[model samples]
Target: MSKGQITKARILHQAAELFNQQGYAGSSMSDVMDVTGLKKGGIYNHFKTKDELSLAAFDYAIATLAQHHRAVLRQHHHAADRLLGIMAVFSSFIDHPPVAGGCPLMNTAIEADDAHPALKARAQQAMTNLRKLLCHIVDTGIAKGELQPAVDSDVFATILISTIEGAIMISKLYDDPVHLERAIAHLTDYIDEYLRI
Candidate 1:
């Protein structure tokens, strides 16, 4: 990468961490400058405005998260195993998150609320992509005869994601991993008992 490319990536990464933790409205260019060791001019040279950086950082965080998902999912060929692997990946977030704050989707969704339309849309898109991934897994499982043919991929995916994301929120809230642990354990049992064929 060129010097400029490297610096821009650095800015994005640092800014992503800052924004994920502090949030868009709560964070400022000065905060980003402090974390990135870059001046206002330096930041603006790469991003036209804080909004631009905020969106870019969100994308960066999501990309990083997707990479983790790909890495873990690649190791499991069975659809059931892949779904379990996805749960494991989220379960690991308590100790080692892809980004600093939490699930970028959850964090962004909550903060974006109705205030930031652009960010709210981005979060929704990211979530939809995730749901699509789960649906794909379920569909593939059905084709492979590894899952029940009658399983509704859309509804199943929604339940899985909603359950896991809620567990993550609860775990993060009280600084307790048990909440996620219980969720993952139940999910694993549920998938094996109901989804697996």
Candidate 2:
């Protein structure tokens, strides 16, 4: 990569961590400067505005998560196994999160509510993609007879995502891992008992 490209990449990495932890509204340009070691002109050279940087950082964060999910999903062929693996991915958020604060999707969704329309839309799209992925996995499982034929992919996917996200929120709130652990263990049993054919 060129020097400019490398600098831009570094800015995105640092900004992503900053935005994810402190949030877009909560974060200031000074924080970005501190994280990236870049002055205003340096940052503005790459991103025209803070809004632009926020959107880019969110996209970068989502891509990082997608990469991790793809790697784990590739290892499991069956739908149940894939779902379990996905859960394991979320579980890793406790100690080894892809970003700093918490689940970017959840964090963004909560913070980017009414005022930040662009960021809110991006968060919604990211969440839609996740739900679609889970639904696709369920569909594949049913087709392969790994999962029950009667399952409603939408409902199943919603349950899994909501439960996992909620657990993440609780875990982060109390700075405790037990809620996340129990949630994952329960989901595992839910998969084995209800999802498997």
lDDT of 2 by residue, 1-197 (tens): 99999999999999999999999999999999999999999999999999999999999999999998999898998999999998998999989999887789999999999989999999999999999999999999999899999999999889899999999999999999999999999999989998798
Off by over 4 Å in 2: none
lDDT of 1 by residue, 1-197 (tens): 99999999999999999998999999988899999998999999999999999999999999999998899788999999999998887888899889998888889999998999999999999999999999999999999999999999999989888888899999999999999999999989989999999
Per-residue lDDT, model 2, residue 56, is 99
How do the predictions measure up, each by TM-score?
0.98, 0.98
lDDT of each: 0.93, 0.94
- C-alpha lDDT of candidate 2 relative to the true structure: 0.94
Candidate 1 has an lDDT of 0.93
Tell me the alpha-carbon RMSD of every candidate: 0.7, 0.7
State the RMSD for candidate 2.
0.7
